[model samples]
Target: MKGKNIRLLRYAVQYWFLLFCIYIGYRFYLFVRHFETGGVSPFVSRPPSVEGFLPIAGFMSFKYFVLTGIIEPIHPAALFLFMAAVAVSLFFKKGFCGWICPVGTVSQSLWMAGERITGRNFRLPRWVDIPLRAVKYLAMGFFLVMIGLIIRTSMMVLFFITDYYKIVDVRTMKFFTEMSTATAVFLVVVGLMSIFYKNVWCRYLCPYGALLELVSKLSPARIRRNKKACINCGSCSKHCPALIDVQHSESVSSAECFGCLTCVSYCKGEGALQMTVKIPKKGIRSVRPVFYVVALLIVFYSFVFVAKVTNHWASGVSYQEYMKLLSKQGPTQREHPRLP
Candidate 1:
């Protein structure tokens, strides 16, 4: 008999989280509106969850924290959120991508809609697919070089202290509210492409996902196959959103595995596929989907709760600072004093 499938439960969790994210976005909009209107509107305090959208800023905060042993005051919530993501990857192997990320949820929804309409999603030939998948890694490499290498230590400190960094959240808010023609077109194209291909942006262009994949290589929890009980069936591979060939491998160690457990859910053969940990000489240990889900939530929210208790969840910038910065009309007017 097949094990109890958790795919529906996973969907429930994804949609629940997505709804919470949408609420955060709306709350943030009101907060920014209060500033943009010069306090004419009723004030809504900014939600710390808005920092989740600032991944690039979070990356900087993470590096600065590592080097200086301080979480920078500008976007401290970003650092906490970033650390939570890394922790999830360390223990659960990109479970954040599968369970929590709004972008991933959107991508999954688009592809599922496509499958419903067209009967199935399509895969590229290996020659084309292999190169396309490298695009995310290449993008990750570019950021690593730009932030990790080229930007010197003193410059990073100065950059964080600048007025521009102080109001980056406002700038980000404007970017989405005032989307340009080019950005609109790019999103449209990506959306349409996702109809035919599974997770087009995630599979080929998400630098964040790429970084998680690298970190998750060290994760102990993995999908293991029982060859002794195996009937050669390709169900696992067929259901895999990441296109991993789970049937052929003794252990699913691929960086592409997002820990969705679609493979484990689909396998009907007894003891054929399971999410488990295998230590040398210690033997294999099975892990349930619910356990992974609970673990991920605990790690992520625990960090957030600690940050709140420590008063690091909110930005240090004051309301007066936000008014002075956002009063400027456009990007050109809001340029940092230090920028050329």
Candidate 2:
């Protein structure tokens, strides 16, 4: 019953975030349509939060900031959103991925749906899984290395100021709304895979997840088991979405541990498993789920609040400016305005 309540609380939070993403998508669609229809459609203000989709842009923005000490003005929100996600992972173990990411929510829902429809979701064999799991990390590394090379070439500044960079968000929208045959097939394959295998994209292809997992490796927080309190029921291991062997493991500090607290919530013994953070001189103290949730929310929003106060939350390019850049864009626009 307690575990069910815990799962329910997580579901409420997940769906709330998913709904918010849907709302953002709708508003952004209207915002794009206002430009696409040449002032015929009702205008809507672009939501800065939509920039959350632009993590690569955020990555470039971070690199630009580190190199030139200036935030990329065109997608200022991208930098802040990326920072918030990294902060969440640093302190709360990929809470952004496990709790706030729309993609993650969809992945979870797809697997849940599969379980409901097919009676179970399947895990890959360990021999096949380990190498596949490294794919995300390899992808992340490749991106970072490419970015580092770009920075060395000093083309980063030129890339950022390009008209192409300014309107990439619109291109992103079109990628979904106007998928090519290849793109459609690719998505369908991925969707089907997600139904059969839990977190197919998340576990194998998400460079962002790999990045978060890397940062979370430094987090002092982990799932800890108390031998005395444990009933040796193996329920925690069975319930762990990440497939961590929480039943026998004294510490679950793996990169796979995204701190979802499933093991703790599903533990049959009352005090067997806990989410704990090691403190300076205070030892490891158990953290309540409510407290963890509160801290995660506060940490994430605090970054946004800072960005807001500093006038870094919104793009410097106004709606009218966007109108000008997107003036020639039509329903099936293919060419993005190149470096200008």
Candidate 3:
């Protein structure tokens, strides 16, 4: 019991550091927008629609300029940072999901609440799990083949660079801070769905998660099993939030494995499962909790630092300016402008 308490304490401390890093990243973004443009306003904003060259990239206020072709604008820093994120996941597993994802936190909290309400835990069968996992991959392929490969490489390059892509200016953040009814409804449904399923959005739907999974399968850093230990208690499988059967397999069975080390903490068998450079009987000597925390911080801050550096050289002007310029020139072209 004392040992378990100690382990839990370590976990809490690690999470504290990771959370602090996330706070830093969030604050840094706000600070830049506030200072540079008078307040935390969107550099570009518009209704969620695909009619423009800068269609919604994600839930974030930013967009990938590489998606459009204007001045050959590409955020190399973000590209490298995202690449590094995938590379790190290869060794550390999906530390991003377990540690830093705000959505993951909400899902886990919901699962805990459900467990408290009903003594029975929710566990999906392997048949359901296998097919559900494929959805993320399909979504990823759609974006890659359709938007990334075909559109960016072909017609979008020509179509996106014109004035029709213009949408909104720096004032867009104010629009969101004061949410309309439709945005409120969307948020409510997302929140409810998150509570009902443990990372349902991330596990089965997120295209980014699918990309991470592909890279994570090749990660050298992993939890290995010792067949000789022989107890096969199956405790690790039960505790795995990803629902992976860690006990039976030499390697983690699913890409959903987030390297949270819950299995490592719960395992009673000596040297049964451990982290390793080369699947050691007992893995690395460093503090496991510290490693988890550091990895999470690295992922969060790397994204922020790149955003900050880019803002310096970025046109960073809003779409509203272009729209106004276009309106003055002639007719009010309802057609969204491409990246100028």
- Name the candidate that leads on TM-score: 2
TM-score against native, each model: 0.93, 0.93, 0.64
Better of 1 and 3 by lDDT: 1
Candidate 1: tens digits of C-alpha lDDT, residues 210-259: 99999999998899999987787889998899999888999999988888
- Clashes (N, CA, C under 3 Å) per candidate: 0, 0, 9
The Cα local distance difference test for each model comes to: 0.85, 0.84, 0.56
lDDT of 2 by residue, 1-340 (tens): 3677777877788899899999999999988887777556777778888899999989888878887788878898999999999999999887888878889889888888998899988999999999999899999999888886646526877887788888888889889999999999988998998997888888998999999999999887888999999999998987677777888899888887868877877888888888899888999899988888889889989988998899898777765567677755543333332211
Q: Candidate 3, which segments miss by more than 4 Å at Cα? A: 1-81, 153-197, 279-287, 299-315, 318-340
> Can you tell me which runs of candidate 1 are displaced by over 4 Å?
1-5, 279-281, 328-340
Top candidate on lDDT is 1
TM-score between candidate 2 and the true structure: 0.93
Clashing pairs in 1: none
Worst 10 residues of 3 by lDDT: 46-55
lDDT for 180 in candidate 1 is 100
Candidate with better lDDT, 1 vs 2: 1
